[model samples]
Target: MTRKFTGLLLLLCFACSLRLAAQAPVQTLLWKKQLQARLDSLQRANGFPGATFAAVLPGGEVITIATGIADSVTMSPMRPGHRMLSGSNGKTLFVASALLLAEQGLFNLDDSIELYIGRESWFTRIPNAHSLTMRMLLNHTSGIEEYLEQGDFMQQLKGHPGHTWKPTELLAYIYDRPPLFEAGKGFSYADANYILFSYIVEKISGQQMYDLIRRDVIKRYGLKATEPSTKQTYKGLAVGYARKGGPFPVAGAMVHKNKLILNPQFEWAGGGFVSNTADLAAWAKAYYEFKAISPALRVQMREGVAANTGKNHLYGLGMQIRPGGEAGMSYGHSGWFPGYLTDAAYFPDLDVALAIQFNTDNFRLLKRAPEAYLLDMARILATQVNNH
Candidate 1:
């Protein structure tokens, strides 16, 4: 070979390697900057204290960003590890736990709630109780009413601030309410379903809800910062914030009212877990990889039910399904509570997952903004991953 030809070939190889190396970090940085810009814009537009987000690619790459204060009062900055209430997102965890138990042959998905909890005279007194089942509860097809909508339940609790509720007592509050529709006929989101599921976990596993989740789910994934809400502030925790004038804290409440607050005990299992973005990302990866549950159960978790009209929102055992368009589809659940909002999604085709948590009650803005921005960011990240 001629020296000049050899030199040209070597130059081509060097340029190619440099080009490849430069592309990924450049794209990653650009994606990060874009997410930061969106977060800033949302905070400014909505007057929220701040927001935090964390994401992990299928290949195990991760990015975490905390923009804004966790609490306007103390001027604490939001950090990746700052724990926030996961609200209904806890349902995903419960569902996974239920499936894990099912895989162990403890119970079947189609088993009627009556088989476990039994048809007590008190339960039968409630309308439509006969149709309730474990699957119905997990899939939100049980026709149970949400406890949060009970007349002045919050007011009653605020009046008795020191009272701690047993799961049965909390269940009693909603058991008498009229069903939204026939069991297995519709998908009306209800906390009562998960509250019952938590009880079932205790009944079957003979273990408390917190202990089961810690041993079966959180510990298995090595999730260091995840815990059931204590309804009291802990050291090194992020303070929750409501929108400037939101219904949270309601009127005439005391003791941890009107601030970034959570009643972890009351909302146990249904919506009272607290976790940071990093732990969330790790959990999502573990969930999608079938490390938390069996592969068959994982498939069941991602399958959509036809509880509501038009096939519902593609809900599986615990996770929410986002159907793909041109960008392909993703699956996972999002959460909201008095002072926090979170989203964690995994794209199967791309093998990537992203989680975001904002410690603000600006649900109006949060509902619309973060999902759109994060999905766009995911696309960009996927491009970077594929190019390399």
Candidate 2:
């Protein structure tokens, strides 16, 4: 009787294990299918030629999804490895590097701009330039006007495609202009802050901003696809598109115009990095896992900074923080450029991070799509991995 009982127990245990094993891959496959379906729907509806997505679970399980074409003109299908412009999303990388320096005690976060980069006289030709600080620059609270909004700036860009821009020259274009508000008084989305912050990164690190980012952040995290914009031509990079008559071009148009090919020197260190979904996912994982920076500093980076009441989307060191429900919150940054839109988010409680990018420039389409899709996909993927 004892022998018979032992055999039956072993059989039962084996069956249970088999059942669990069978269920695991099925769940993963189902999530992947659903994600693919969602991507397809978005592409058809929004006229985007291509989109890429990646997610990482706390346990380190990874899934990457690519749909549509990398270049619609070439009819090249989007690949997992193709690089795309990150635009403002690049700021997150800069912020991460800054935190690493802060961890080393290079500079205090609250230090004034005058302390590190000299006084307003340095930008004496530009009005109110001295009131800016390192913190304000990081948080977009600096009063410095944005160069991109200047009427002549865009014209100059189109006319002088190969023009190499100096940081001071870019700032000079907006010099003497009134700030969006007094320094540290309000939050306004200005690229000027990052342009200045890039200079500070160079001044403090004694390394060019691009090289510093590559060494301190990208290589440190083992990111394979992240590279400085200076290294590649935008035309050869992953194409960005908008709808035919819509706000953004369709993926096909992006490939046709070679919008991806351009020199991003003017925006270097501010919004010039290029990467793909997979690398971005890995970056968020390293960042939130505290592998890239100290845990203490990570907390500070995620913390919210005070800003305009109407613009409650307060800025952090190098990120934007939006308050969530009672349980916890999400953290990440969003980027938009001529032909690309990207956003990434990490849920601390869930231990999951998701990165999504579309090869389109249309803000209107983005407004139509729920930002929650990224979070929703992350949640679905995380739940599946956990259950397994």
Candidate 3:
């Protein structure tokens, strides 16, 4: 070959190689060696029946890895795409739906929730119901107690485990309870806030909350695996377990079925959704990273509570701000229900997002904070990516 021709061919090959390097990093040692190694130890150490974790790169590529078993009884391995209950992470969707509607001028966050549900019998007895604004509900400042914490209501749930309660029925537990404080006077996390917000969405949108979210948000964005599962079970869901042990907080010395008790309908607008690691990683980019709302509104949605409280933790509309969640700070929510633990976080500084779900939960029984574990998982992803 002529020297000139050879030089030209070499230049072309170099350019092609550069282009390939720019593409998403394929599966790496991060997944097989580091992540799997660490996650396997963590899962076994924590006693999780199965768990899944995912990370979204700055350029929108995703990596999902799983450990342990999906069903402890059957020993089925957890896969990258296996669906798990979303727990409180569903708050992200409910809040985002409300914000999107507000952005479109369909509603206003400052509007009184009573504007929609005041006439309903359930709200008549709820203290401060007429004075509560949609913003209060989103931020958990509405003074409404969470329905799940009521001993009487929980007894009913336990007594009739097979019965499903409608949204109004869930309200029965909240309506009679005394307000924790005057409207907007305090910060509290309450599922009742979102459940009631779902009512407002249905009233104004003239569709079920599930339909509105499905059509407007999840569908518009191409999240095929993420779906609201109120009362409808998805196939291949991972089995959840409650960790049992003597006193050391070991994960799987024994496990009990911490079956999800809050009927899906009652969980409404709060935590009744299902998703997998891959979809959640994509959803983080699509929904939280700009697929849905405007950048200005994203800032507004995450403004968090007043600074006077001096609290380390901050709660945004649907997200939580972990002051020390990453190399810089981050925003996301962690989800916990009986059998499932789900968590996802987005780091604006790193431009990376991570989602993780575990089939075992001992938060209530073992006093273990599931979010901390999930956050560690995110840190590992960030550490590996940054090193690579």
Number of the top lDDT candidate: 3
lDDT of 3 by residue, 1-388 (tens): 9999999999999999987676435534344456677778887676657788887777666777898888777788999888887878888877777777888888888888777877786667875877899888888888888887765775676566557677777767786678888998898788888888887887887867777778776887677788776653466678766455422222341222534333444566778788887777666655556546778788877778752222477777887877545546667887876567887877777677778888867654323565565566656666766765
lDDT of 1: 0.71
Runs of candidate 1 with Cα error greater than 4 angstroms are 1-30, 244-248, 251-262, 306-312, 324-326, 364-370
lDDT of each: 0.71, 0.70, 0.72
Steric overlap count per candidate: 2, 13, 3
Model 1 clashing residue pairs (backbone): 58-351, 240-260
Which scores greater on TM-score, model 2 or model 3?
Answer: 3
User: Residue 268 lDDT in model 3?
Assistant: 63
Give all TM-scores, in the order shown.
0.85, 0.84, 0.85
For model 3, give the RMSD to the true fold: 4.6
lDDT of model 3 at residue 111? 89
Q: Itemize residue pairs with steric clashes in candidate 3.
A: 46-251, 47-251, 47-252
lDDT per residue, candidate 2, 250-357, as tens digits?
222433355434466677756778888788877765665566567777777777776542235656776666543321366677776667778776667667677888
